[model samples]
Target: MPQRTVDTVIFDLGGVIMSNGKPSDFASRFPEADRERVIEIIMGPYGQDSDHPWHRVERGEITMEECRSLNRDAIIESGIMPILSTMQPQGQESSSTGGISFNFSLSEPMVQLIHELRDNDFRIGVLTNNVREFREWWWPLMDFETVFDTVVDSSEVGLRKPNPAIYHLTMDRLGATPSRTAFLDDLQSNVDAASALGMHGIRVDDDPSAAIAQTRLLVQL
Candidate 1:
């Protein structure tokens, strides 16, 4: 197949355009708990769309409160609740009953890049596996309506990342084909999925400069 020039760029919300809020990032809050185990119980195999409470919440199949209840129960049963309790009191301001905060900040660098892409006429879109309740928290971070051609929230659409359908949906909404699109995500699995569909996938790390540079190169900005 002939090469296609990139015209569309898709971004993942958390850890990409926004500061980190992944399971690992949350796990770090509980220094007393096993980080890997904490991440597993909280996120429940994020690389795949499963019946895990976290995944269900992301798909809008269940409410965040319900998922939190479920996760709390699991933590209690696993004997980690006590450790978490020592960190913070119950009913405190937290993303979950486990007291892990979901607080995140917008990445100014990524925001600037989005503006640059828009100025250069590249179609921009956001595909995020986000919670419905947390929409209010992230929406105000950016003028999304003006910046993005489309914003596909997993909670709104019942599909999440690493699931090929969502990628196709974003591409369809952007009126861009896979070969002519570039996707940036913090998760390697998500990036790999986009690459599998023929889109240029760029993984954003702690320092987004590398991913930003890669994206500019791919789109020849």
Candidate 2:
């Protein structure tokens, strides 16, 4: 494959190469009876904003109890019955499992592509807007040191996407100059932020196949 100008590729973990299609897609997996309500509770007007429980969870500032409280409040404010069935407690000391559990299953194709990139001498890294406790769920599934040259978890650094500082941190850690790095993210704002820093930026869409195609096109792989 012909090379693009970028020397390093930075991917957002959730939807770029992982099997998570979209955050809202999970609502469809619930029982039909709970579908509408769950979607409204997790992906509706309150769902998209930064003040939501999920947002706070991703940021790692709030405890699990605080997340549930926020979730309950979001549901009630949306005129729906509150259900804490999917809320999981935060912190290692807690033994509750009422909140959503995040799972990141890498597609075989993505895994192969990553391996190929490394074999071809490309530097790879991950910059995700993940919870502080993300390693509790991800470490067992993937090799951070082997699969990625560097990882900048937003929660660990206290800087989330659309914030240029986070992206700058990633570039610094990866030793990649902005002109030599390409960033892929599920959100347009995140991509735009990367672009502002002089990196090639690609927005991942809902379809995994489409996202993969976009990645290949951008990388010229």
Best by TM-score: 1
lDDT by residue (tens digit), candidate 2, 34-152:
66577657644322336666666666777555666667766667655433323334542333324455555666666677787788788999998776554566667677778799988
Clashing pairs in 1: none
Q: Report, for every candidate in turn, its global Cα lDDT versus the true structure.
A: 0.85, 0.69
Summed over model 1, clashes come to 0
Evaluate model 2: give its TM-score: 0.76
Lowest summed lDDT across 10 adjacent residues in model 2 is found at 85-94
- The residue-by-residue lDDT of candidate 1 on 1-221, one tens digit each, is 33438989999998999976566666775677898888788889888889999999999999888998888888877776433433343665655433443456888999999999999888999999998877756788778999999999999999998999999999999999998899999999899999999999999998999999999888888
Clashing pairs in model 2, backbone N/Cα/C closer than 3 A: 86-98, 86-99, 87-98, 87-99, 88-98, 88-99
Instruction: Find the candidate with the highest lDDT and give its number.
Output: 1
The regions of model 1 sitting more than 4 angstroms off are 1-4, 81-102
TM-scores for candidates 1 onward, in order: 0.89, 0.76
